[model samples]
Target: MSCFEVVDPLFGAYVLGNAPVKQIATGFDWVEGPVWFGDAGCLLFSDIPNNRILRWSPSAGISIFREPSNFANGNTRDKQGRLLTCEHGTRRVTRTELDGSVTVIADGYGGRRLNSPNDVVVKSDGSIWFSDPHYGIMTDYEGFRAEQELPCHVYRVDPSGEIKAVLTDFAGPNGLAFSPDETRLYVADTGRMFGSDPQHIRVFDVALGGRLSGGEVFCTISPGCADGFRVDSEGNLWSSAADGVHCIAPDGHLMGKILVPELVSNLCFGGRAKHQLFIAATTSIYGITLNRRGAQTP
Candidate 1:
C-alpha cells in the first residue's frame, strides 16, 4: 500500500513524495521526542527503554548523544536554542546548556515530587510548559516505578522560577505544542495509557503572561492515541498515531495521514530550513522532507 493518504486535496500539497517515510535509523527500544537542531545540522531524540538519547545526521549518522538520559521522553529547544528535556526517571524537567552542563529546571511542586514530565515546549517569553503524567512512574522499563504525589496536569514555569498548574482536567496528558504564533496551545490526552478514556487533543487560548483559557476538544483520533506531535508554521498539527502520522487542520479536521509502516510515537520538524519532518516510530526513526516548515523554524 502507498504510504501517503491524502484525505483533502490540500493534504497532497504538504507531502513531497508518494512514499517519503524513509528509515534513517533503527534498533531502538521505542523512540520518542524527535527535535531538530538546525545550527548543528542533526536531529536529537530519545530512546526511552534504552535510557539514552541519540543523534542523527547526514554526515554523522546515528550516535549516542547521552546515555542514562534519566529515561528522557520529550525534548525541545528554547528560544536561545538550548535543549529542554523531560526526564521520566528523574521525574523532572531539565535544560542542556550550551557549555555542555545540565541545569535542573523543574523537579517538584509544593515541596512534593512531580509524577513524570512527559512532554515540554518553550515559549518565546522564555517560559517553560510541559505535561505531567504518571506513565514514567508506572513502569520500570522507562523509569523507576514510584508513588504518585500529584494529579495529572499541565504546568508553566516562568523565568522567575514560579510553577503554576494551568490545566488539571486530564486523565493522562501526553503531548503538547504551541501554535506558530503562540496564540494557541494544543495538548493531547492519551487516556488509553492509564485508563479507559477518549483519545483526543484539546486546544486553549494563550492569555497574557502565558496563561491558558478556553479549554475545548480540538480533534479526536480513532483507534489510537495522540502521543506526540508538532505544529506547522500554518498551524496544522502533525500528530503520531497507531498507523502513522495524522495531519489535522487547525479547524480540527483530519486532512491527511502519512502511512508509516510502524506505529508512530512522536515527530518533529528539523533540518536547516526546519521543513523536514522526522518520525520516531516504535523501534526506528523515519524522516521525510516536507513543503511545510515547523513552528520553531528559524
Candidate 2:
C-alpha cells in the first residue's frame, strides 16, 4: 500500500497532462540534500540530525551510505560524477573522490571559518557555488557551535580551488539551482531563522565566467516558502514549500502542487529515465514518478 494519495485532480499539471504516482520512504530524523546517481540507479540523501547519509534504490530499498557524515546537509554531483557535500559539523564543503578519499573544497575565506555550508550546486563550467548561513552552527543538533568569525555569504569556488564570496547580504540563503540553460541562478531565501522575507525566491543573471549580477525577485511562494529545489528539462522549478512540492514554470507561474503531509526539505530527479522526483521531507523520504525528465547534469 502506498503512503500517498493524490488529493488534487491537477497533480499532473507539471507533467503535460500525465498522472504520477508518489512513493514514500519512511524513517529518518531530518532529511536534506538529495542527489541522484543516474549511473548507479539510486539516490543519496543526508539525514542531517542523524549524522549519516542514506541511499535509496528501486531494487535495494534503503541503506546507509555513510555514518558520522559530519552533519552533511546539501549534496550534488560534479562533472566527474564525484559527490560534492556541504558538511555542517566540519564547517566545510568537500568532495568525495572515486577511490573513497575526501578532499576539502572550501572551509574558510579571508582567514575566517565559514558560518556553515548549507547548500551547494555545480555549474556547467565546473565552478562550485554554495550558500553559507549560520543556521547549522547556531544549534547543537546539526553541528558544533563555534563563534562565527565572518558574516554569512554565498561563495563560488573556481575549478582551480579558489573561493570567492559572491553575495553577502541574504538573511538566510538555503537551497539553490541553476536554470537549464545555465543563464540564471535561483536561490531560496528560506529565512529559516529570521522571519525576514518568508516567501521569496531570488533570481540572478549568471554573468560571464562564473559571476552573478542583476539580482531580482523571481517569485513569492504564497502560503509557504521555497526550500531546496531543482529544475527540470522544460525549465520548471520543483521546490518544497509549506503546503507541499510546488512546481513553478519557466515564466514564474505556479503550475501545480505535489502535496506532502510534512514540510519538504530538498529534492532531486532520479530513476532510469530521470523522470522520478525524490523528495526529502521533514522526517521521511518520498518520491514521485514524473512524465518529464529532469535537466541533465552538465
Candidate 3:
C-alpha cells in the first residue's frame, strides 16, 4: 500500500514513499516526544504511561535513557544542547545539564502550581515555550490525578528566569512549535478530545517584545487533530494526526500525509542531514526518509 497522499504538487516534493517506513523499536505503552541528538547519534523519546525515557541508536538499538522519568511527556534540546523536558507527574519543566544534573526550569507561576507542562520547544532567542494541559493530571495512567490550580495556558520562560503566560485562551493547549524563521508560532489546541470544539492548530505572529498576536486557526486535521509537529526549512509543517502525519503548508493548506500503521503522537527531524522524520506513535517509533530538511535550531 502507498504511504503518501499528495494533495498538492508541493507535497510531492517532500513525500518520498519509495523510502520504506522503518520501525526502530516497539513494546511501549505509549510513546511521544521524539528528539534527535546528532552529536550522540541517538534518538530519545518518552513512554509516558511507562514513566520512563527510552533511547535508541543505530549501534546500540534500544535501552533505557531514564527510568522513573516523572512521567515525562515532551522533550527538546536547547541551543546549548541541554535536554529540556516536561514532566507530567511532577508538573514541571526541567533541564538536564551537560554534567548530568537536572535543574528545574518552571513548575509554578505566581505561587500557583502549574497544571502540567505537556510539550516544550526552545526558541532561538533563548526562551523556552511550553504547553500546559491537564491531560497528565486528569488520569492516573499518565500521572497523578489532582485538582488543577492554573488554567490551560502556553508559557514562555525567558533566559533571565522570568516566566510569562503568553497565551491563555485555550481549553487544552497540547503541542507548540515556531516557524522556520521564528516569526510565527503554531500551537495545537486538542480540546476536541474532551469536548466538541477547538481541535485545530492556532497560528500566531511573534511580535517584537516577545508578545503574540493574530491568533487564527491555521488548519484543521480531519479524522484527528494535531498533537505535535515540526517545520521544514521551507516552512511546511509535519503534524502528528490520528491517521498518521499530516503535512500542512505555510499558507494553511493540507499538503499531504504519511500514513503510519499506528496513530502518531509527535515527531521531529533527525539523521545526519536532518531530513529523517522520526515519529512517536502509540506503541512504536517509526521513521522515513523525506525530501525536505527540518528547520534546525541555532
Best by TM-score: 3
Where does candidate 1 stray beyond 4 Å? 192-194
Task: Name the candidate, 1 or 3, with the larger lDDT value.
Answer: 3
**Candidates sorted on lDDT, descending:** 3, 1, 2
Please provide TM-scores, in order, for all candidate models, with all chains considered together: 0.97, 0.93, 0.98
Question: Pairs clashing in candidate 3?
Answer: none
TM-score of candidate 1 versus the correct structure, residues matched by position: 0.97
Cα deviation at 142, candidate 1, in Å, is 0.6
Q: Write the per-residue lDDT of candidate 3 for residues 5-106, one digit (tens) a residue.
A: 888887888867589788889999899888999999999999999999999998999999999999999999999999999999999999999999999999
Show model 3 residue runs off by greater than 4 Å.
none
* CA lDDT, every model vs. true structure: 0.90, 0.85, 0.92
TM-score of 3: 0.98
Model 2, range 1-298, lDDT digits (tens) per residue?
3333243444444453334445568878899999989888888999999999999888998999999999999999999999999999999999999999999999999998998899999998899999998888888888887787778788999999999999876878888899999999999887747556555888999878977887687888756788789999988898888767888877787777777788888888888888888888888888777777889982
Report the Cα lDDT for candidate 3. 0.92
Residue-by-residue lDDT tens digits, candidate 1, 118-203: 99998889899999999999979889999999998999999998999999999898999989889999999997354788778999
